[model samples]
Target: MDFFAYLTRFYLPFAFFVMGESMQGISIKPGILVLVGNKQLEIIDSVSASKIRARDLTTGEVLLISPGEIEFELKKAAPMSNPNSGQTERTSLIESANEADIELASDRYDVLLPIAGKRPISKKDMIQCTEALKLSASQVYRLLDKLDTNIGPLSLLPQRRGRVKGVKLIEASAEDTIQEIIDQHYDGPGITYQEIFEKVKEQCLAKSIPVPSEATVSNRLRERNPRALMAKKYGSKAASQEFEVRGGKVLPEEPLELIQIDHAEVDCIIVDSEHRQPLIRPWVTLAIDVYTRVILGLYLSLSHPSTMSVALCISHAILPKERWLKLIGMPDGEYPFYGVPKRVHVDNAKEFKSKNLEDSCRKYDIKLTWRPKGVPHNGAHIERYVGTLMTRVHMLPGTTMSSTKNRRHYKSEQHAAMSFSELREWLIREVEIYHKTTHSELKCSPLHKWESHFKSKNGRFSYPSIVDDQKRLLIDFMPFKKRTIGRDGVKLHTIDYYSPTLKRFNIGSRCIARYDPEAINKIWVLPEGEQNYIEIGYADLRLPNATLSEFKRAGAKLRADSKRRVPAAEVFKLIRKNDALVNSAVACTKEMRRMRERKKTRLTDSGHPLNEKNAQQVKMSTSPSPDYSVKPRPYDIEE
Candidate 1:
């Protein structure tokens, strides 16, 4: 009998079947941590055929959930196997292999992945792969067999030909002596390979072991990472500069095959619309298509870089720009670039690594990749583009000019004239101009390059898939929360939300909810086992819309005032009051400055009360009001 039948016969209380069929629970094992929406939960135990008990890591609350609630596996548990079995063997093999062997194995694995499991691999494909890997057909088949046994790069590493790995020809003492000499002197400045070889030989002899041949010593010295050796001899910066030039470039064949996203604080200061006074330097997130070098989408905001900025930038990139341009009071057809990219490359910023970004990309089958940590050159294209764009910004009215020395005697704040919305419009117009201007590398405008790629060849034009649901796309990219529905509504961060459609779900059923960071008054809920999302607005409609930051600030103010149980309405009221105070404060400051100016003028006036005594001491004729009635005097009576 199978495992299920054996369990059923032995344990009568265990329910292993549902509807006369074996019902296996989720594949996730107990004790694994999973991300369900924004909460991290550790699985405790399987409770039923379809449910598992878990504990919330943040709140330390225990609850039961189904497989559908899991959004991502934070840590993957290893397979059940013997400690000394295949896992251990593979691990040891990988440890024994060097970096070059592993790189070669990885390349071979990638080449063979296309036809990994195909039976009787076609001669044409086999020949192509063999040619690419520079391997014989029989050797390729052997590697394929090894792959079937162990599906990893370790299985493909080139096997040692003569002596087995870790069974060295030289004695352990001699090997240690060579390594010591190499560490002490081999990487020094002006050291030669012959000198390193001679030193290794001398050390090996001194250790009283049979001296290893010069060839072996030279091979050991060569085995060190060239970059690491260079860094040890010179400096890390010089080594980096030497290796920064890449042999290959990012050359995507299609428009949306590759895209890059990055954030930068704008050089120019922006003012508030009402006050027309300098507010702050705003941040801008830009998304560019690598293939055509076109600016696909951009988001400008006064807030700092965060997951919301990334989500909004992605949303803007995916959705068509016509509606956005119209909303910004620009020509709708100015920017036509829009589509889901096949792969998105970003820096190793926490915002780029957010689970929200991963979920959204996974939902659309888009690949998200990050550059290696501390490797800024991987993002060279975007960085250079940002620099070029900032150069144009330096021409603006309130530009800070990239550095303090460059901005000497330039009062950015006092000269600030453009409002936030006005700056946004200016940026859009500048983007249009950039798209039409010729690029130094491309020798053609970005827009022209984009159009040329889409031009028809053989009656077929290249076009990317357009997003079907714009609102849903935006909601999918926003940060999510998992909460159980209740009789009242969903309470998120002390705010209660309700909608009539929420009545369909069970009282305590957990659901996924996403909120726009710009507006905390509303959220979209994907009810349990439901595909469509229902809109949930504030339970108290009297509360006005406020940003997440504003709400947080209001909550902090209430807590500082020693108020407990701060209601949503009360928090929003404080937000409104704070906003009013900010606006009034600006106006009050302007008025106070004007009043001070008038006071200074009055103090300096010649006819001031304090100066009247000094004026009386002077000649009275000089101080007397020149009588307009004596205007009859002419040049003839000048005497």
Candidate 2:
């Protein structure tokens, strides 16, 4: 509902802005909140305050608020996961760069080499030399064969067209070639030999100077300066994902030596479309700096939330001001950032494996390290946050559901997923609030520490200038699918997948699969995906737990259910009846026997339990195996 209508219904004294209490029912958890009384407001509860906020209720005027909002806002004791990308940047660095006396750039490397080093070379050393000289890729490979002075006396340069300037190629003493490098913009971005050739041809054609045929002119140039005629294509453009952090004065540390990163999937499942119920939410990617205990980046996405997202999160959260700008090649007014971190802590998620993200770290000399799989404890810091989210936000009553409409009948249903948009917003607000408040993990508010640590009285420490290289971190998509193994193959969302991987796990078993974003030929088995994809494990299936009342009633209805003619119904009835019989008022005497047998059995068959023959002396009372429903009891109501 709109704010006006909501305020009117509540009969609130004054208009108030609600920061994140938009949700209808998030106040089911425990928390102490402030409330107004006959005179003034008062602080409520939370055993022994611990840096958490609580206004001086006795001094301020009473502020009337709903109980639900109070609990929802205050009772928010659960853990939270947020995107790691640093959203803030320094503006002062930009002003400084623009006002700097001179533009910063590496000196041209051409001055370092001898004239003999110029040749058509294609060796690794030659490529390095070309790069060192600030030469283009075309220049690099063209001079490959001429890498060493010992190889040849002359070197090759990539060919290009140019125009004649003063002296014409044909008329000016066939011994020499003359051309002007006109900026046609056609020979590519830089000034090259091609432009001079094109200029020479045009100038000769227009003037009285005799122009030679294209072939004769070319042959003359090649014969006179063959080493400069080596042709090379421009190198193919490629990009990778990266995140950067630099230790202050404070130098960056070695890879993984000082940094480790970890990530987690959000607890709530998100709707595929606002109209449809949520598919399951994928992972929540996070990167942390181990030493500082700072979150480097956080990313929330519906796709599997790959390695790139994690890297992007790290990129968003922190950057080494100078290196980031240098790597990106940004202009003065563009990007600004605070200090970078020394190390990054992460889990085994592939996003951390991003070659692109790694390259970014390498460029800036930042370290990136990851933990092995199945070791949640290793990433305990982030795991603690993820756990809190699961217990508080995800498990909250009437909070998450297939959709808004689904919540209306939520009491009847076991649980529901959340909409993606809603989930994203919740995470952001939660994180922002988390940063605002102090945390147990860092023993202080993250924002307070981060700002205090990096910010100066004048302004924030040097900030990064975003470059194309910095922005080149690739984001990719991997569509989801669901399945279970059937005799014929693995069935995903009713679709059959017959692969060698599935054969090992076999049919009749459900599995989740996602295609690789980089390569379509391979697929990955996941624990869960957005709704349309296969749900992986038992918990992912959203299996409903049997309530205490349901269990009791199911046992009591055994007699009536046994009369059902349907075999399946009858079977359930018999099973229920047996459960009751084992624990019936008449079976109190049998309990003692069952107990003795349970205690005596040291071991049993591979997959089955112990026999229940010892539960009763009556030969007819025997059952083949231990009862699935029965449990040890100290007292028997039957007695």
State each model's CA lDDT, in order.
Answer: 0.74, 0.40
Candidate 1: tens digits of C-alpha lDDT, residues 1-639: 343342232222211111111123235888776666766677999989899899887577998998888766643222211223545666576567776777777678668866764555789999999899998999998887665233255568788878775466777887887788778886657888788778877776666678878788787777878888788777787689677566676588878888999999999987655546676787899999987889887987767788878887888888778766654456654888889889999998889998879878999989999998867777777888899889999999999999999999999989988866678788888889989999888899999999888878775667667888877787788888999898888988788999998887889988998886666767888888898989888887767666676688778888889768777777888876755665466355643333322232222223222223434555455564333324456686686
Tell me each candidate's TM-score: 0.55, 0.29
Expressed as tens digits, the lDDT of each residue in 1-639 for candidate 2 is 343342232222211211223235333222333222322223443333342223333354434344333422321111111111111111222222221111111122122234222222336655566667667766544444222211111112222257633344345532233533222222333545455566666676666466556566454444442222321112112111011222232322321234344555554544433233334444566654443444445555444555435544655555433333232232231222223455565666565666656655665666766665644455666666666555556454334443457445454123444544455446655665655677765578766655565567898663333334332222212333555556655443222335443445544555556532322212345333222332122111212222222334454565366654332233344444544554454433433333222222211111011112222232455455433445646567756
Clashing pairs in 1: none
Estimate the lDDT of model 2.
0.40
lDDT of 1: 0.74
Which residue runs does candidate 1 get wrong by more than 4 Å?
1-235, 238-243, 458-462, 563-565, 586-639
Which consecutive 10 residues in model 2 have the weakest lDDT in total? 78-87
Give the runs in model 2 whose Cα sits over 4 Å from its true position. 1-260, 290-294, 318-340, 349-360, 372-376, 395-417, 441-443, 457-470, 475-639
